[model samples]
Target: MREEKGVIIRTLQEDINNLKIEQASTLHQLSSTLSHLSSTLSQVADLQHEQNALRQELRKEQNQRLTIQEEVNRLKSKGCQCDNSSRNSTLLPHDIQTVKEAITFDLQLEMKQQNDSIMSEMSRMEKDVRDVKAKIRATAMTISGLVSSVSDLQTQIYFSAGTIRDVNKQWKTNEIIVFPHVLANVGGGYDASSGVFTVPKSGVYVLTCFLSTHSSSMYAKLILNGNPVVGITAVTNDVSDVDTGGNAMVSRFQQDDRIWIQFYIGHFLWTMSDASVSTFSGFLL
Candidate 1:
């Protein structure tokens, strides 16, 4: 009986030690999980801060673009009237070229920065995923949220084109005026052959058209999916004088929607010997 009692006590003590070992192991695992969660939270906070900074930068860039567009509109409002006006009108195309170049440069820089940011974030995320592979169930929601936020920062789309040659009386009413010369097609949405811009993505866009005429009156319409949105006309009475007219509109478009310039009412569209006068441009906002 005495031996049996000693054996029972020993068994109870061993079981108690085993339970304490298990409890200590569980505490250590919980501590590690909490630490990982804390680190993940800190990373998320940093990413949120960076996203806010990026949004502020984007707003500033958009404002700059609006200012440039206003300047272009101001210049276009001053049509050719006298000899001095004609001289200034000659410079108008150059001014437009300069503005386009500046916009392209800024867009390129912005795209580069955005690409770098995306790549860096992607690399960091990959590392985080690898580090937390065993804890995927815990961090899955956090990773998904980060991916969604990054996706919101999309790239801009824009295009600018000009009439390559003199569009004579061959252009009839309701005909699409194809601008064969592409000055800039950043998003590859404009087709020089078809003279149509196919919407690459669904978004609000700014469409603009500028026409120049010599000794004739010309009218053009901006068409969206076979519907006329706005019209522009340039009328010149003197053979030696040039007149300019333009129209700009902001509208929404869906992916695969078509946009083009149509000859609404015009005898002919003229182009300068050294530069193009008729231009069509658009950008996604």
Candidate 2:
């Protein structure tokens, strides 16, 4: 591994050195080219100056008793550097300067376009990041709400029970005991009119049932999901007449499971307005 790392480092250093050498060579070449261009422009300007001087001399000689063709010959024989025949010689310098200006302008425009593209790309990426963060925040809030709701459901409980007030149903089979005096129905799981308690959520629940007999004996079964799960018997033969019995048990229930008290064999129970006459209850563990 160390040998590999040394080789990689050596390779990178060599590459960097080569790149620097190439860059320096390119800069030298560019400098030489610019110097040559400047020299040529200067020489062209000198030639134009000489040409103006020759024109001035020709004009003066024309006024001095000489034929125009002879004056041209004299001007040519004087070794004056003037070529009126070709216009390209004068225009070439301006063209070269124009080309240089155009190249500079194009380079500047290209650079500006590249910079704008980079800025636009950066802005788009920033917007995408912001949108992602917003979505994450919203998702986090939804998850938190769901967790809170689940916590509440996990810890919830319910209970209820009662007996009818002074009303006497003498004797019958399958008689559902209507607990009329509602004492504690915390979660509204029990319906007083139906004489039944429904499971609010599916879980293990503790249920209790009780009844009081007056002037008679009472027998009932705690009915759960249409089946008897527990039984209660209370007998009162004396005039004092307040025999009470109850049972409690734990059972698993599903959603909307039903429970109630059902009297069997015409057994009787009495409900009074006073507290503790008879009561039933249930709660989650």
Candidate 3:
């Protein structure tokens, strides 16, 4: 009996160790996910900055064009005043014509330069607009994909027992131990009232069971759909002896499959102040 007890203890310890490893892995995955999201947000910020800069440049170009138009209008008004003064004064007709020709030539040259500059700037602006539009579309698609990824990660199935009341209940053979306390029931898979977890999906899952016994030997089994998959025993050699046993297992189950813990032989001693209360928990991989 001692050798068998030793093996059971070792097995339970191994299961707990394995669960710790799995928990670490899950944490690492979450960290990676957060890092990726941060990077994506940074990219989005950069794109927004580029768009703002582009808009500012467009406004600056428009203001420059308006200033050029005002200068052209001022030059035309001065030319018209000069023509009227020449007509009233005693100036030679050929000299007056020469002055008018020079003014007309200067105005034409200024208008051509302004038009060329505007056309070149507009062409460049159009290209920039196209590039920005393409980048915005790409960023939008990336954000959509990230949102879907986050949603998939959010869909998790897990549960844990809450603070169990100290009842000191004596359980007979093959009686189901109902842990009324419920700490968590993500995906609504575990029924605290029934002390049974109904599998929410068809997948591999990790299940754990713990028990604490005082002054009595407790034998229990982790049951799957009414069949025993694993057994745990907590034995006490003296009246004051208190022992605790825990077991964890990774198994695959179909949707709607039931899991619970059953008492084989034992009297459970529990208290509100006790630190080593029995617990049951499970989660999908």
Candidate 4:
């Protein structure tokens, strides 16, 4: 009876030790899992932060664009005929000539003023764009840092971000691809022709177009989705001087967005000289 009791006590001791071992193993596994989860959450938080920063930057850009557009509209309204009625009351042939001359002078002055205003507006727009670009660079840097830190925590959390150009050969006219959007073609034409370009994906995209001219007083205006954008003009009447050169138009696109460039076509005689139409190119960011 004494031997049996001793055996029973030893069995109980062994079972207790086994249970303690199992408990320790469970605690270790839980700790590891919790650590991994914490790392994942950290990465997610970083990404969310990046997204919010980008949104703020985007809002700034949009506000700038709106401001510029308003300025443009104001300028357009000012483009109407300059009124010089204060100097027009004396009716005589000589006075009429004088009035005509004065009106011409006033027109020239207004034109100069308009040109100056346009330059100022353009400078502001460029500055704002640069600011946005800097923000993007900063965001990219932040992402790089986050990615580096998370690399040790998880090997599969890296994101590939870059630009790709000329993904497809067939582009439609008037198709514009805005940033955060894929490229789209509105109508089909190649080389310097004005048409809409569309976006197939949603992301940031950089766009470019090329147009050329061989005649003086000839200008090409690039329009993004029916909105007038950049303008290029030739200084000489030589084909090669303006020839072999293409007007590059760039704009950010969104999904299902459209863009295109239209030339004044009055003096731009080189549209079909070298190429049949204008060509548009862009990439995903």
The digit string of per-residue lDDT tens for model 1 on 1-285 reads 224324533554564466556556655655565667777667666656666666676667667767766764554454223334656566445355455557657766866686577567656656665555545555555545544433433344778788757766656789898889888786799999999999998988877788877767778888889998899888888777777788888888999999998887757777866666788888765
Q: lDDT of each prediction vs. the true structure?
A: 0.71, 0.64, 0.71, 0.45
What stretches of model 1 exceed 4 Å from their correct place?
1-38, 41-146
TM-score of each: 0.50, 0.47, 0.49, 0.29
Whichever of 1 and 2 has more lDDT, that candidate is 1
Candidates ranked, most accurate by lDDT first: 3, 1, 2, 4
RMSD per prediction, one decimal? Answer: 45.9, 29.6, 9.2, 40.4
Candidate 4, residues 151-199: lDDT per residue as tens digits? Answer: 3223111011111222222223333322211233222212122244556
The regions of model 2 sitting more than 4 angstroms off are: 1-87, 91-134, 137-159, 164-174, 184-189, 198-205, 213-219, 233-243, 250-256, 265-273, 283-285
User: lDDT at 171 for candidate 4?
Assistant: 25
The number of the candidate with the highest lDDT is 3
- The better candidate by lDDT, 3 or 4, is 3
Roughly what TM-score does model 1 have, to 2 decimal places?
A: 0.50
